[model samples]
Target: MKNWFVALGGVLGYFALIFLYTLGAYLLVRSPPWFRYLFGFSSLSIFFGLLARTFHWASVAHIVLAESILIGGGTLFSLFWAFFSKKRPDPGGGAQRSPEERPGKSDSPATFLPAEGGDEEADLPVSRVREEIGTLLDAGLSVLVYGPTGSGKTSGVLMECLRERQAGDAERSILLISCSDGMEDYDLLNRPVPASPQEKARTLRAMAREHPDVRIGSLSRLFGDWDRAEGPLRSAFRRAAGGERLTIVFDELNRSSVSALNLILKVMDPVLGHYELFDFTTGERLSCPLDRLVFCATCNMGEGYGQTRELDWSLLDRFPGVVFMDYDARLEKQMLMDLGVPPDLAGRMVHVALALREAHRTGNLAAPLSTRHLKNWGRLVADGADPENIAPCLWVNRLVSHDRLGFPDKDQVHGIREVLGRTFRGGRKS
Candidate 1:
């Protein structure tokens, strides 16, 4: 009885020691490929060695000794093989497919790598503000289209005008200028003159000299000169007052410097019908064109993504027609579907975006997920990338999250994983 009990204890102890050793080995390596190889070879060796022991051809002590040695040896070989092995696939990151390797390239309605930039001008069909723009502008008010990036605010304005122009609305010209910091009067005006006052005078004079019929108006003529006649600053108003209707696009107004924006404010007073522009050379009242012109401005929230400045209430009051562009989950999903994103994956990506947006509502995120990100995810899906593998790259990394935004790195990652897991496979509805 004592001998049988001793043998039973010895057998259990030996098995426990071997299990502990294998578990410890795997935990130390903690690499999936290494663990796989280590366990594979070790298990096969142990199985063959145990078969010999079962046949009474080998002793239990010998079997244990041999199995331990084989597992240790397998562990070393696995480590060596793993060092040269390719990395395990990371579900949340990486560009696994190239442009040619991506599906539907030969017969698809879309060709885009999302997250890089505009998806063919915001996929114009889904735009909703076109019809309302004409009415808004006709009200004698400057219009402000405010929204997230890629919500199509700038494109909405231009596309509507382009369609009108193509349909023979040729009298009016649609001019677009992207606004940014340190934007000078020359860039805004698109004048044929240099930035320096000397160069500006020289260029204007040279042009006048070349055209013998033209008068190179004096500095006095363009300046307080303003009290006598309009200066060059009221350029837009001058055109408007001259009965030449124009649509001026102020793209990304928030990105412009305060001085640049203040320049716009001078000319954007609808009630006064004009703004006072100081002489570029003299810094005095140059001219005021009192004819109200069509001015359209697009604004992004600019909290995280770009350089932004708050607008003066006085300047903002000029635009009574303010439209907030919000992303439509349904429209976005439909867009991806039209672009050949499979229905199931498109639906999932949309849900993911919706979830991110909802999470933003809770103030967990500094920026809401843009429809642009959804399109990106859908593009990847259409290209045969798994959602789980692509979501981290397309979704989390795309967030405007940073330490300054109050979300720590771990928290941001955690939040992203929680949201993705719930929406993708955890069976939680967005």
Candidate 2:
């Protein structure tokens, strides 16, 4: 017990030595600022020595090897601490954007909103999908915004719609729905989570009879039982009086269940004049009144990722308009700038993003660079994260390999460092 106490005292003495040395470093090394770095180096050297002895290092050769390990270990530890703990000039990262900075806020040439002279009746386009839905929205048509995952298809569209909702009438609103499950199937019929097809259909018909103009907000109540009807029925009178039109956003359409697909088919039934559902309890039919709903679905068109399935041409054509949503480097950079990334840094990062996308296209990369990655990478850089470490922390470690055998492609993984070097340092920095 006495020996143990003496050992602990020695350990404390060693730490005290490091602390004193670090304090000296902080006072003396001002040019490059090697304070905590010196502490890390000394601390790691001590650790390496202890580790070597624990492995029974006693011979001169083993002791020499341990000393060599300590020097290399110390250098690595010092450099790592220096990079990880690096501070930025402004912790906020960049200048905040004023209203004048927004694309539509000025008439100056710097303004980069869509060139003027749009149709008087047309709503502004959020993305390419706007070309179809923006012009023909009032025609009661539904649309599918198809694209690669994490491309901002749904988020961008929803943001614009929400913006419109703020200015538009109470009658025009967008609802974000989780249709990955067969939500429409169960909810449309007014059945519980596991109700049979007939029970749901029957309740839907009863609810349909009373509701003249179907409003989107009351959709939840439409699927539950009210004892008098199959599902909870909102006052049809209120819906008619509101005269509200709905735009439904079905997120992750590719992951939707079979039942959801069936409900979608019913929505596409133009001959019915409204979206209708089958009811078994009453042997009657339920339908959304007036057919005033607009549907917008976001999906990944390609296979080999997630639970994506190929849409049949017949079902696909039911969606008269489709748009491919992909990454826009300019918009992404602007978003990063908005999120507090300095302009030059944002541009460099975006350059890397475009380069990565190109690499993915030309088969140099295993996975495509998505907006999500760009945003995360930008934020990390803004917070003073070293791109060398941040790159792997954000994605490399988290990604599943192409073959699912192990790590992602070696060349692709190596390219991340090369990309970061060019992007962050303007070129390789020592």
Candidate 3:
């Protein structure tokens, strides 16, 4: 009988904890007055019943009745709270308050913008791509990712870094900057630039709260108004290192002119490992204490895009490692499928894209199909448009016409057909 009572007590205690936790959640969710009252009454009943049973003040029948009432009442109250609670008014008229308006806002770490689909743990379809990146990072080698638009290159890098950041490596920082000249002064240091300044500031504050050490800044801002000859670039490098591991990514490095290459030289120079240059604005220069700094740059290969005056050997020699991001039909198909494209359609699309690329590469067609063109074509096809009926002219217009392989009067359609034939033949053999 003693052991039975103890076991009963344990079960009751567990239920009590559950009820209290539910009540706490209800209070947080701002349950309605009636619902709150119901919980209060149920809690009172349970407490008295438990006390009465322990003291033998009531019969077993009385204890059973009290528990039934408490459970029934609590269930009804919780249901009512879930279905009928009225939302509270915005504490400060919904006109958009700053992060400072909320109490203890800074105490909580900043939350990242959830992954693209709001699922933090969903695996990316490009496992091979992820594997390659993991290898580079593990080897302590910087990686330069190159892919056409919509290839998820930027998202992949950011997502991987985010996972690493969450793994408790607090001293590391990952910085991403756009190659655009006008993006200076934007607080890209911590948060991405949302469509408006308010969003940008909110994100920055959130980032500051969560990852206070991870600094985001623009390339233009880093070099803006600083004399290249006076070593502004070197100063920025020291600040970035700051006695910890740093991963600096330059997105679309080729978009910037050859002038930007000079900045690259300063950051990559072996001598920079010894001492830092002082920034004129901040008046601080010190040796970078950290031994690990990874420099990665992304750019379009010199094939389709207009050449930004060839980088001299001095600059080229700095980046000894390069990862060629060639077009991968299988990878593309997998990516499309992950983005909700049907398997059959994705396979067909990838087939056509690769065929067109091969035709162009072998000089069998007047103009090779660039990744940009393939992406546009994929979008159109995914939208249920007939790929064959779409104007080839629309795509050709987007290509660098002056640099096109055989534009204006070449047999472009024939080239596309020949590539399709070869792709189909290969498929049949398989």
Candidate 4:
């Protein structure tokens, strides 16, 4: 009877030891706050229990007492450990600093705000943009501005140049070209071409008088015919460069075809004489210049708009700077206000615009909306048209379906509704 009773007690103790070991293993994997204390106590209990039995302690009561003391002490130690392990708050109060600054230091003027908006007091004079045209005369480096639509990139850069020109900066000159096929040719000249020779002369005189330092030209004029200059369109480039420090702005670069893009890369190559020859009238070769010109190109991120073309890796490498233009809520609101949008309406419209963008990103929508759509929508809302009254189904039709601008139909609105239903719940949470 005595031996059997001892065997039973040993079996119980053995099971208890296994249980404690398993618990420790689990605690190690998860390491939750509460488990820390539980593991510590259980481990100490197992250790004391084993020690008491091995030494043949005086009685069951004495063994139990030892186990309890060890468990209690371990629990106390775990509490102390938890206290020390807690993460402390940062000394800077969790403020974000720019990449260039030290952890606690503030950022510089150029780094802190958007490039368009510098410090109020030290803001670069708008007129300096034109003067800086001469600054690019030597063509130190080509610039690439990558931003979403409505980031004020084209307007900001061009406006600054115009401001400089107005300030009497005669040495600087610029040429703006749009690769987009949708833009009208007359738009390039900033007016319609005259039908009569007399009218044409007048237009030319006005252009020279207004923009004396700058000469407005287009790629179409340089090439004469787009289809004919298929194989390495080089001549126009050579003439455009002409050893002058010229700033060339190429907007909507993604609209250009792959072959045209490659041709551009070849033109930009410094090793090759920074110009090319194109076949002109009378079988003569026309040389286009580019060596002394600063090239600035703009492109959109590939977010499902058909306008974007896949850029070749080699072409991407030539342009050193790629600036990402993201949507800034604060700036968007300010821009809306500047456009005569009511403050309240602008705030709400921006929120909806951001929500729609997020929905598209998450695969809840079929197409991405443009900044122009958001601005137009906000304008309509500000004009006293109820947003809810606008057909919910038309969202996709108006913004996503066709490249051309206008309102959407019923089926399009349904698609938008489906997307909104899946992604948003009253615009409060996603």
- Predicted structure with the largest lDDT when compared to the true one: 1
**Model 1 residue 34 CA deviation in Å:** 41
Model 4 alpha-carbon drift over 4 Å, by segment: 1-140, 147-153, 156-170, 181-244, 272-291, 301-303, 390-396, 399-430
Off by over 4 Å in 3: 1-132, 145-171, 180-245, 270-283, 365-373, 391-407, 417-430
Could you tell me which residue pairs clash in candidate 2? 190-223, 201-278, 201-279, 202-279, 224-232
Better model by TM-score, 2 or 3?
2
Candidate 2 overall Cα lDDT vs. reference? 0.59
Clashing pairs in 1: 91-389, 223-226, 231-287, 273-290
Off by over 4 Å in 2: 1-133, 138-140, 158-162, 181-184, 191-243, 279-284, 288-291, 398-405, 427-430
Compose the digit string of candidate 3's lDDT tens values, residues 120-238.
12321234666666667666666677655434466545346435743666666666555644332212212232245564555566666776665645432332332223232443466
Residue pairs with backbone overlap in model 3:
110-209, 110-210, 189-216
What is candidate 1's CA lDDT for residue 395?
59
User: Which order, best to worst by TM-score?
Assistant: 2, 1, 3, 4
lDDT of each: 0.62, 0.59, 0.53, 0.52
- Answer with 3 or 4, whichever has the higher lDDT: 3
lDDT tens digits by residue: candidate 1, 321-403: 88777775556777889878866556656666655665665555656667666777777778887776677666576563665
Better of 1 and 3 by TM-score: 1
> Hey, what RMSD does candidate 3 come out at?
28.2
Candidate 1's displacement at residue 393, Å, is 2.3
Worst 10 residues of 2 by lDDT: 105-114
> Between prediction 1 and prediction 2, which has the larger TM-score?
2
State in Å the error of residue 372, model 1: 2.6
